[model samples]
Target: MHVHNSTRQLSLNEELTMSKKLIALCACPMGLAHTFMAAQALEEAAVEAGYEVKIETQGADGIQNRLTAQDIAEATIIIHSVAVTPEDNERFESRDVYEITLQDAIKNAAGIIKEIEEMIASEQQ
Candidate 1:
């Protein structure tokens, strides 16, 4: 675990509390490897780029880490790297959403995150 030299250790919840949130959903037709691989890549990339990630992985079992209404409302960015359309996708109807393939997310998540950072920067200006 990465830690800072501070008087107190921060829990995961505490660390994420002040963060810029990024929400993602990753799925694939088979609901197997690609579904999980892409979600992990995207989450790692987002965290390294200073965003807190809340990811939903859809597979044969079901969705994990499902996003809540509050999570969606607070998200600074939303990405869907999916082969199959997500089950509850309409939650983002009024939000700016980005889509990518599972392969793209797994292979180029750093580049994807950098681009997203730039996009947010330009929009803020």
Candidate 2:
């Protein structure tokens, strides 16, 4: 019984330590459709996966919904869906970063999240 209790406690602790937030930086060469579309797709996918998500867009309109230091710190992972280099990328230098194309983010956002989730689970194991 003590062993079972300990195991249960450890599981709970692990779950608590797992982050529930995601931060995405989406950009494109023209700062147009791909940028905003990818951001929207990622946000929707993250939300459907029950994660608190913040998506920053670097487009022709410039950076919108810019992510802050606190957001980066709380995120489980930082995803960059950009054709061009994302701005302020130094902020994610020490983060668990995932890179994907803007089109991929827009078309397969759910798959991207699922893959990340699997990666996280594997790391925990």
Off by over 4 Å in 1: 1-18
State the local distance difference test value for candidate 2.
0.81
User: Clashes in each model (backbone N, CA, C under 3 Å)?
Assistant: 0, 0
TM-score of 1: 0.82
Candidate 1, residue 96: Cα displacement in angstroms equals 1.0
Q: What TM-score goes with each of the models? A: 0.82, 0.85
lDDT of 1 by residue, 1-125 (tens): 11111133345575466468899989999898999999999999999888888999999889889988788767777888999889888776666677888998999998987787787578546
lDDT of each: 0.80, 0.81
lDDT of 2 by residue, 79-104 (tens): 88888887888887656678888888
- After superposition, the stretches of candidate 2 with alpha carbons farther than 4 Å from their true spots are 1-19
Residue 75's C-alpha lDDT in candidate 1? 78
